[model samples]
Target: MNIDTIELKQQQLTYPQLRKTQQYLMPARLTGNSGQPNGYDIYPVAPLGAGKIFTGFDTLADYIIKTKAVLIDGFGGVFWDKVQQQLQSCFNDKDLSVNWIYTETFLKPTGEIDALVKPFLGADDSVWGTKATFDLIDLFEPAIEQQVPDAKFDINIVIGTGAALAGWASPIIYLDVPKNEIQFRMRARSITNLGNAKVAEPFQMYKRFYFVDWVLLNQHKKNILNRIAVMADAQWPETINWMYQQDLEAGLDQLSRSVLRVRPWFEPGAWGGQWMKEHIDGLNKDVVNLAWSFELIVPENGLVFESDGNLLEVSFDTIMFSNNQHILGKHAARFGDEFPIRFDFLDTYKGGNLSIQCHPALNYIQENFGENITQDETYYILDCDDNANVYLGFQEDIDPSDFRLALEESQETGKAIDIEEYVQIHNAKKHDLFLIPNGTVHSAGAGNLVLEISATPYIFTFKMYDWVRLDLDGKPRPINIEHAFNNLDFSRKGDKVQQELISKPQVIESAPGYQLVHLPTHADHFYDVHRLEFDSSVTVNTDNTCHVLMLVEGQTILLQTADGTQKQFAYAETFVVPAAAGSYKLTNTGSGRAKVIKAFLK
Candidate 1:
């Protein structure tokens, strides 16, 4: 099918109307007396009665004046100019003399930074970069110690990305911007990379940010998290909302031992679908199609906390930095600060097929990309049309060299090849689980809503073909034939696809009203999946591993943790029960049987 025909078909296809549930989009953990989850922009944090939270610049400036010296360190993409402007306005009439220090002044030269990051930024690839190992302090000059004045003014302030490196034993105010907001600012050309003075193209900038800037800044943030006196939400240009570090710690502690949900974000893509757009109530309907929902990708997601009526958000890593052992439990020793599992949605309903792709093997990823884990994925079909199909494995008589030549010719000549001749196709049905370990070729075909559960090191897909369609920007997506060729497992073809790649569900435990069915993942997978089908309620033990669950087959279910706190989750809503929670009970709140898919490290 051509692009125009696909577009017309997407517009004309009629979808089955599902019940619209608004709570799943912006799910939040209500702390203290907080009643509701704040809307999409602002999250809510309940007061812990520890350090005081400052709302406006005047109050923040008042707190600043009380201290002899203050350091403002934060994540990348913060509008430092706007921050300085607002603070200067707040301090204009004060009798105190202010001395300002910007950490950027002590940064290494641009050429030096570019050279330092060259190895991590792969050659001319807009989509990938190797994770860097350097710290934020390495980017700054050693003379930063001499920059801080010995003679203190009434108010001495140091601010910027690495301001904490100034070594001032002063109150630290950390400004945080969510990952989604950072990308928005990058797209608007309002923010540059950490040490750069000029903004580059959004795609290139994001590559650098992911591999270099964010890596270094997150380490810095983690190192100084305990020292921070206040955490500021600097997403707004003119105003700032901040909470006490002790309060944030309280929230993080609560999250570590309790059930929580990271806020999910949605994005549109060229091969996007109408499933999420029509079914998810709070999503913006103006977009052409919603392709992916970052359901529980903790690396890019944020946890929101509510206090009184005000809301504040911090990156998901903050929880890991604070309570890794509590959140991860037995897995903490191996994974450390990294949350090893990810769950997201791949919506191809009424859209196009995903690009034919395979992920790198564990050794290849570790040696080439410096990643600790590989992207071994599984596609659990949540919903699908009757004609839905999944492209997987390979044809029985596939020839590697001929397939490579055909792919290269398609890339050069813009001619489509018969993909089915070289690859295998399987009809997809709802609730069918397909294993896609590293080196397995697969794609979610059209008319399927796939819930992808996998390792956390995402963005390592090597696309072999893309059906000759241009992206939303009217540009061809990058093809990674060489990378795919190196990783693809030619042995996983023909009958082996059906015998091993397809998961078989078996009832492992059953009661009168509840049954726990094991959806056996591949032997290479480090995690396992179980489906809890209950007519009334079922209790589950954590078994000393974290549980990532989604309500897949029911309208709603109420989760009661061991701590006696209960929360309700709707269909397709993803939530996490920390390993410290011990055990939890799920009650089917709707009329039908509730099926919740739970993934835990095995």
Candidate 2:
């Protein structure tokens, strides 16, 4: 039955007015057990030595004055105007001889940059783009060296996103902002894409940032990690948190050998749901709905560290950049700094069905998108109503030409086609694992909370249909029938989908009050899944590979790492166990059996 025809009871539609008790939305790994858990500390700080960190702009300026010259390099979306004003004010009070050089002066013209990135930006409204091969250096003018003043001053400050390329042999202070904050700034029109002076529309701006700017900046950040003398959290406007590079590296090293949890962020969408808003505490209830929780999508998430109650958050990439080998272990050689696995939430509970979509094949993605990996994904139903369903694969008599014609006609006439006539629909149940390898057609229907496990290359969805609904901004979402047709696997239809796509659970190991069940993934996937069920406690070995896990069934569980460090995780909370963490133990803190779903690179 279609989503519109499905009858849901009134009780199924009513969400609990009270938030889920003891549901810890902001989970963090602490350096020690001395500090109390604070769900409100979004920017947790890792402790550092006494002389390593500088708090305010005044303190940062004092440290800068000690050196003759310094280059302040950072990511895009930074408030360069605020940085200039604050530092300039501090320097003037000290009567220091300062020559301030803003990197914007050396940027190539906007038209030149637009032309350079046009090939990668795709169409005006297209969501997908090939990864750019250009570097941060290419965005600057060839005569950047000449732009620097030859005369010497007491303190020469060169600052901006690409300030380090200004031909300065000075101490570099890198300012870092998380990806979520950057998107928020984009929505507020307070920042522009790299090398562009005026902010484009939010959606178009994000498209450019994801396809071009972020690609180049991430490479630049990785290149400069070793050279940065100081790392600053630039999310805040007036105040700043600066720490010595050595200390930041130390914190990363500590985390590589222990369990780590990347901070999760939530966003509202047109197909958003009330599950997260009602269950996840600390989330703002004023929004229309919380559709997706970026549980552990490392590309856009951040890792927060707490040091003496002060918090600092850095982009999750810094962890891989600093210690990929320790974090990924044997898989490090193949993936390098890229985290191969991703875990996120697709909350459609009491909302709408996700867009009927399919991802590109490995060869298609690598050739056309400049990506090393494709978006191979699986949906684990975390929770669902009685009538919840998942649309997967195709009908037995499906015809590609007819399907394409119907989709195109719908796009043209704004008419709804009977999607189930072509796509297979399966009843979704809690803990049902649905495998969606690259090129597989699939989508989570309404009234279900889905824990999406996949590879790291997200945002490559080739949508064929979107239920003929306008997006949150009252605009039609993009449809990619041609792209979907290029990748859709017609052979995965009828009974074959039920036999292959739906995983069968088999108990692999069991003991008194404990059982380990293997939820096998598709052969095309590079990762595997396991569900650990225990009433008291269970011990698991990392097996020299990283493990991404979530407490799916129970209310609370305590995780103890190999080094005897312990942390508590609540239901639906996601955390990572690095390869170097060795073995860990989980003890049920709440009553009843606790089940944790574990995903690791095979």
Q: Write the per-residue lDDT of candidate 1 for residues 1-602, one digit (tens) a residue.
A: 00122332332232112111111222212223333321222232323443344567788898898886899889998889889888887788786678999999999999998889888988766478789988888889997756665465777899888888988888899999878778877876778897788988778998999999989988989899889999988865656778878888978888788788887878888899999887864455767888998898888998876554455678999999999998999999999999999999999999999999999999999988889999999999999999999999999999999999999999999999999999999999999999999999999999999999999988899999999999987999899999999999999999999999999999999988888999999998999999999999998899889999999897888889999878777788888999999999999988889899999999
Which residue runs does candidate 1 get wrong by more than 4 Å? 1-53, 149-152
Which residue pairs in candidate 2 collide?
44-305, 44-312, 45-305, 45-306, 45-307, 45-311, 45-312, 46-305, 46-306
Error of 2 at 187 (Å): 2.0
lDDT of model 1 at position 193:
94
TM-score of 2: 0.92
lDDT of 2 by residue, 140-231 (tens): 88776555543667788888988778767778999988788788777768787988878788888888899898999999999988889988
- How do all models score by TM-score? 0.92, 0.92
Global CA lDDT of candidate 2, please? 0.84
